[model samples]
Target chain A: MKFGVLRFPGSCDDVDALLAARRVGDAELLWHGERDLKGADAIVVPGGFSYGDYLRAGSIARFSPVMESVIAFAGDGGLVLGICNGFQVLCEAKLLPGALLPNSNLRFTFRQVELEVVQEQTAFTCACGLDGPSPVVLSIPAKHSWGRYYADEQTLADMEGRGQVLLRYAPGHNFNGSSNDIAGVSNERGNVFGLMPHPEHAVDELTGSKDGLCIFASMCLAVEAARV
Target chain B: MKARVLIRPKAGILDPQGEAVQRALPALGFEGVANVHVGRMVELTVEDASQIEPMCQKLLANPLVEDYEIVLDT
Candidate 1:
């Protein structure tokens, strides 16, 4: 499967994402504002200070020309994954369900975070299927001043009821003060996934952990599943 | 026409950046600063004021976590 990693002006993790995608399979980096999705089977928006986080985390980046194509690509059933800053962009663009606010601590927390796979049906989490309800142990670094995720009670309930809550910080251990401890979520279709953790950072054991491989691999499967 | 857009986080949502600014107010020599709220200021030149709504909806503010006000400068 061909993977397209977006490279915005200030995107810090574009290379990391490219490397991770390369490890998983064939991949290429697509510069932001290029006005095209390049026919990528799947697209990954990596984390970074796109537009220097001027207006908000992802607020400014959403207007980039690349997003227009990304939106169209996602609308046509192409798999899309947004990590950290990318998550913020997806929310800003209304491609995903909720918004990411400041972490409750109001501080940037960077460490090995544990994420529970709330729903494995999304193309993003199809690989990590642990038996029963135990949360999956994946080590990924997150660095953002506004990483808190928020949604109204009713909307939150609906997302949960519909199995759209794709991932969350481990129970009782949410690093960022996200409502419902949600770490990630997908739309009703489950084709688009957004999460706060940096899955690209975890794809290689040389950098840190290798638990993120499943997520990228899962996206490939998700694309193929949609085709079938 | 010139317009100013004020974007603030929605009520009940946490604002860590605002909190940081609030904490620094006293250190900056403001004793009466009991509260500090932060928002964005975007200046735009539009042909007609009607474009403000769509601009705010599309880029200025996220309806899910923030509310925005557009003021036209006469």
Candidate 2:
């Protein structure tokens, strides 16, 4: 499975995401201005201060030429994963259900967090068989100020009913004060996924936890299955 | 025509920045404050006033997290 990691002008974690994707399969960098996805099986929108976080996080980057392609790619049931600021971009593009607001404490924060896989059937978390009967929890790092997940009560209910929610902070680990402890979510169709946490940063066991690979490995299997 | 777009946090939405500002006001001796909410204003001159509303919906604000008002040169 080949993964394409997008790089906007101020994308600080683009390379890290690319390196993490390479752990599972072939991966390369795709510029924000890219018109074509270069035949990547899956797309990863990496985290960063894209467009210098001007106006709002991911608002400007959402208009990038590459996103047009990403939108079309996602519309076709292709696998797409957005991490950190990329999740913000997906929200701005209306690819995801809710918008991420500022952290409740109004402070930028980053730390290792415990996230539970709320939905195991989605393409993003199907490989998360982490020695659990059900409801697998993984240790990952989450960062940024605008990571508070928010949706109206009705929308939240609809998403919950549809199993669109993919991950949630485990109990007290709701660091950003996300709605319903939601740390990650997928679109209604389940092909597009977004997470406020940095799974890429957690790929190396030397750094602390290798739990992120399960998510990436999940995507690899998704792409592989699609090609079959 | 000159128009201003008033974009405010939607009612029932959490505004941490506004809450922080409100909390700090009492310490500075500015009491009797209530509903201290902050918002953004966008100024523009357009040929047609009708287009301004569309602009606000498309770019000036995020509908899910914010509410925007259009005023003619307010």
Candidate 3:
């Protein structure tokens, strides 16, 4: 599988995503201005202070040229993952529902966090074998001021009914005051996934945890499964 | 024309910054602060009045989380 990681101006984690993608599949850095997806099987929008977080995080980056292709790719059921600032971009782009708000503490939060797999059947979490008995907990890093997720009550209920909530801060550890403790969510079609934590940053032993590799591995498995 | 745009988090949404300020006010000897909410303002020189709403909808405010008003400076 080939992965295209988008690089918008001021994007900080694109390289980390590229490194993570390289470990799982063929990875390429895709510039924001590029109109095409470069034949990539999956697209990853990495984190960063895109557009210097002006006019709200991910708001300006949503209008980048490459996003047009990303939107089209998602519309075609292609796998798309947006991490951290990328999550904001996805919400701003309307590919994902809800909006990211400032942390309830009124401060930037950065640390290792445990995320519970709420919806394991999706392409992004299948590697955890969620259908098996035990719950899957990922040790990943969450970093950002605007990581609290918010949606209207009805939308939240609908997402719950449809199994769109993909990840949440582990019980009693909801650090950012996210509504429903939502750390990640996928679109109704399950083709697009967005998360506040940095999975790419945890894909290696040197980072003290390889828990994040399962997410990338899950995508690889999904791609292979689709090929059959 | 000069246009001023005010963007605020929706009423029902949590405003941590505003809450922080409200909490700090009592310590600073201010009393009877019923409620506090924070918002941002942007002043722009626009060529046309028609562009203001689109600007608010597209960039200045996220309709999902914010409400924005555009006022022209006469």
Q: Write the per-residue lDDT of candidate 1 for residues A62-106, one digit (tens) a residue.
A: 878999999988898788899899998898888998888777886
Tens-place lDDT digits, model 3, residues A1-228: 999999999999999999998888999999999898999999999999998999799999999999999999999999999999999999999999999999888788889999899888889999865444558888899899999999999999999999999898998767889989999999999989999999999988888887888888889888889989
Candidate 1 structure quality by residue, lDDT tens digits, B1-74: 99999888777666667778878888889777644678888999999899899878877777877889988999
Question: What lDDT score goes with residue A66 in model 1?
Answer: 91
Cα deviation at A78, candidate 2, in Å, is: 0.7
Model 2: fraction of native contacts = 0.80
Query: Which of the two, 2 or 3, has more lDDT?
Result: 3
C-alpha-based local distance difference test score of model 1: 0.83
Poorly placed runs, candidate 2 (over 4 Å): A130-133
- Stretches off by above 4 angstroms in model 1 are A130-135, A226-228, B16-36, B44-47
Lowest lDDT 10-residue stretch of candidate 3 chain A: A127-136
| lDDT score of residue B11 within candidate 1 | 70
Cα displacement (angstroms), candidate 3, residue B53, comes to 1.1
Q: Pull out the clashing pairs in model 1.
A: none
Best by DockQ: 3
Q: Which runs in model 3 stand beyond 4 Å of their true positions? A: A130-133
